[model samples]
Target: MSVCDPSALARSLLAWYDRAGRALPWRKKGNERPDPYHVWLSEVMLQQTTVAAVTPYFLRFIERWPTIAQLATAPTDDVMHAWAGLGYYARARNLHACAKMVAQWRGGQFPDDEEALRKLPGVGDYTAAAITAIAFGKRAVVVDGNVERVMARLFAVTEPLPAAKGRLKALAAHLTPDMRPGDYAQAVMDLGATICSPRNPACGICPWMNECQGRRQGIEAQLPAKLAKPERPTRHGIAYWTARKDGAVLIRRRPPQGLLGGMMEIPSTPWRDDTPWDMAELAAHQPVAAQWRPLPGLVRHTFTHFHLELRLVAGKASANATPLGLWVALDKLSDHALPSVMVKVVKHALAKAY
Candidate 1:
C-alpha cells in the first residue's frame, strides 16, 4: 500500500474543514455536541439521497417530532405519510423502528460506539460510524461514496470500484486521526463534492492538490473508475383503478414485505418482465371485480432495479361493489402514504377524466 503520515494528513484536512466545511442543519458549532436524534435522522435520510433533497425532510421531521421519544410514539402511518415523496420507503420504516427501539431501550440516547449503533435498524457500518464520530465525537472511520472517491484519487488507485473498495477503505481508515476525526471526514466529503468532483475536478484549488497522486499522474478525474452495470430491463404490469360513484378511489395497502411495504398503492398485478398481461391473466389479479375498460395511456415509473410500465384499467364501482380495499376520496389521496409511483398512477387516471 502507499504511504503518508496519518497525523499530517488529518491536520491539513481538519485545518481546511474548520474554515470551509458545510454548515449543515444537523451540524453543530465549536465545542458543542449535536443532538444525537438529528445526527441519526440526517444520516439515515442522506444515504443514497442528496443533501438538498434531505434538508427539507429533515427540517419537517425535527419540527414534527423534535425528540426521539416523540418520534417513537408517533404512529407509523403518520411517519410514512411525511416520508411519502422521499424514495426508499424501507428507510422510513426502519427509521421509525430504530427510533422506537432506542427510545424504549437506551432512554433515547444513541450509543457512542460503532458496534452498538449498527445494532439499530437501518444503521449499517457507514451510518454507525457517522453517528459515532459526528454525533459523539468518537474516532471512527466513515467511508461513503464521496470519501471513496477522495481516497481513490488521493492515492491514485487504478482499480475499479467494488473490487477497489477494500483498499480505499483501508487508506481512509489509516488516515483517520484521533484529533477532530469527524471534521476530517466531512472535509474529505466536501473536497470531493466541490473540488474533486467526478468530472472537471478543480485540482488547482483543492487543499490536497499537491498531495494528490492522481493529479500528479494527470488522471485526477478518472482515478476512481467504476465497473459498468447491466442495463435495467422494463417490467410490465396493470393497475386496476376503481372509483366509487361518490368519487372515492380504491387504495390498497401493500403487504408488509417486499417493495413498497406497508404503504398504500393502487391495486396492481405483480410486475413481470416476460410479457404484458392479457385480459384472462389480468382478471385473476384484479383487486375487486367490476366491469373494466382500458384507460387511455400507460403509467411509467423507473425504480432502482427496473423500469415499470403500468397499463391503467379503469372501472366504475357501485355502492354495493366489493369492499376489499379502503375507499379513499380522490382529493384526499395525499393524506395517505402513497409511493411516488402510485401517485403517478393517480395523476394518470385523473388526466384521463375517468
Candidate 2:
C-alpha cells in the first residue's frame, strides 16, 4: 500500500549501476540498444543456471549464431552439438525450435509483447517478460530469484518464499517505473547479485540501504524465508557396455526429444519407477567373460527430475553387434557427443577394466 517513487528510485539506482554493475557479455554497452536475440538467448540459458556457469555458454552461442536468423537456420544437430557441454539438453532443443519459429514464421523479428513471446517454444513467463523489457524497453515487470530475494528483503518480507512469491511479485510490480523499466530491472538484479547477496550481504554498499526494511529491522538474513527442499530419493538402473574385439565400443543415439536427447550413450536398461534392472536381462545381453571384463563401480548421476544409480556391465565380442547400437573405435569416444552420465560410466569401466 505504501507507494514508492519508482521514477526517482530508478534514476538514483541507474547512477549507482553505472559504477557497480558487473560486466556481463549479454548486456548492451553504453548508448547501445539491447539486442533481442542476445537477451533472449541469455535469459534461456540462465534459467536454473548460475551467471558464472552461463557466461561461457552465452559467449559460445553468440559466436556461433551471431544473429537470430543465423541461429534460426541452423540444423538441430548443430545446435545440440553447440550445446553439448551445457547441461539441460531440453533447453537447447527448445531454443532451436523457438529460433526457427521466430525466424521463419515471424520473418526474423522477435515479438515485443510478453504474451506473444510466451507463445514461442521454450519461452516461459519470466523469460518473455525479461526479454520484452530488456530488449525492447517495454514496461514489463521481470522477476527472477535475484529480484525475488531483493524485494523480499527490501520490505522485510517474512512470508515464506515460493509461498510469498506472489505477494513479492505484486510488490515489485508496484515499484517498477513507467520510464526506464529495463534499467530498473537490471539495477535491482545487480543489487541482489552483489550488494544484497544471499550470504554476508553488503548492506553498506547497497543504494537501497537507507530504505531496506530488513536492515532497519535487523533481520536481513531472515526476511526471505524459504521452505526446505524435500530429500532427493536415489534410484538404480543398468547400462549394457558391449565392446567388439575390433576395438569399437557399442553406442546408441538417445531419442531426439527428451532428457539426454540427441546424444550418444552406452545402451541402458529402461529407466523407470525407481526400480533396479533385472539380472536376467543383463545376462542375456552382456558380452562373453573371457574377452570382456565386467567392471564393478556404480555410475551415479543426478538429474533435475531424478537421481540415477547406474550399473555398468562390460564384455567384448568378436564381431560387431547387429542390433541397436553402433560400433566405434574406443579411442574415438571424443568424436561422439556423449552425455556426462554415460561418459562417467565409461570412464569408470575403463579405469578398472585393465
Candidate 3:
C-alpha cells in the first residue's frame, strides 16, 4: 500500500480550501486574521452541536458580548439565560470562567500556545489545538470529527473510532503544513463535512480523491468505523408547577454541580431508574401545600446518558411565597436559565393549563 505524500495532500486540500471553504460566522477567509475570542466561543458552542444549529447562537453571543472583557463581566445568570436552549449547561459555566480568566487574570489576552490554552476552562486537546492553529496561526494538528473522518478515508484506516483516534491524530499531524495550518485544518474539515461525508461521499470532486485509500478501494463511506453505543436507560420523575394567582410560578435552583447544575427548575421528585414516583410520593415534595392537579400525559426528554419521563402536576397557590423556592412571573420565565428539560416541563404545564 502506497502512502499519500503529506505535502501533496496539504497542497491539494489548501488549494481546494482557497476555492471553497465553509463561510462560518467564526472563520476568517482569504488571509484575514482570525479572532481568538470568536474561535474559542464558536468552538465551545460547536461541541456536540451542528454548524447550522450553532451559527445563530454564535451571532447572538457575539452581538451580546463582543469581547472577552465584556463576557467576563456579564452576570452568571444572564450568561446562563443567553445560553439557554444551547444545551450542555456546563459549557456555559466553563466559557464564562475561561473568559474571566482571560480578561482579568491574563490581561484580556488568550494564550497562544496549546499547553497554555489547555489550562483554560472547557478547552481540551482538540479545542486547544484548534485555537493554537486557527486563532494564533500556529503549526498544530487540528483533528476534529470532520478531520478524523477525512483522515480515516484518506488513509483507509479500518480501526474503529475511540480506539483509532490516536492513529488518526498521528496521520493528521504528518500532513500539518507550517504554512496556513489553520486554513488546512478548516479545509480538511470542510471536505469531510461537504464532500467526504459519512454517507455517499462525493469522491469525484474531492481534492484527494486520487490519493484517498478508501476512495481507491471503493469504501470511502465505510472507513473510520465507530463502535455501537449501548441503549440509554430511562429514568422517571415528577415536577410540580405551582402557579400563584398572580401568574408567577414557583421554581428552585439546582445544586452547583452535576447534571443540570446551577440552572433553575420547577420542584421535582428525585429522578430514579428503579420505579416511577407515584403521585403520593411526588405530592410530599411539592413546594406549596396547594391542591396539586396532575397534568395529563408525561413530559419526556433524553439526556446524553438517559431518557427522562416527567409527570407534571399543576396547581394554583394563593400564598405569595413557598417555604422553599421563589415565584417567578410566567412572562419573566425566559429570563431565568432553564435547561431544555425544565423548559419542556414549563411548556407542557402551560399547554395543558385551562
Give the per-residue lDDT digits (tens) of candidate 1, residues 1-354: 224677877777777788788889998888688898999999999999988999999999999999999999999999999998888889999999999999999999888899989989999999999989888888999999999999999999999998999999999999988887677767888887888888898888777877889888988778798999889999999998898888999998988778888999999889999598886787788887787888887988998889999998888777787756899988899999998999899999898854
**What global local distance difference test value does model 1 have?**
0.88
Q: Best candidate, lDDT-wise? A: 1
Candidate 1: count the clashes.
0
What TM-score would candidate 3 get against the native?
A: 0.96
Q: Number of clashes in every candidate structure?
A: 0, 0, 0
TM-score of each prediction: 0.96, 0.90, 0.96
Where does candidate 3 clash, by residue pair?
none
RMSD per prediction, one decimal? 1.7, 2.7, 1.6
Model 1: pairs clashing at backbone N, Cα or C within 3 Å: none
* Residue 203 CA displacement from its true place in model 2, Å: 1.4
lDDT of 2 by residue, 84-161 (tens): 767888898899899988888888789999999999988987898888888988889899888899889888899897
* The 10-residue segment with the lowest total lDDT in model 1: 1-10
Give the RMSD in angstroms, all C-alphas superposed, for model 2: 2.7
Model 2, CA-based lDDT: 0.81
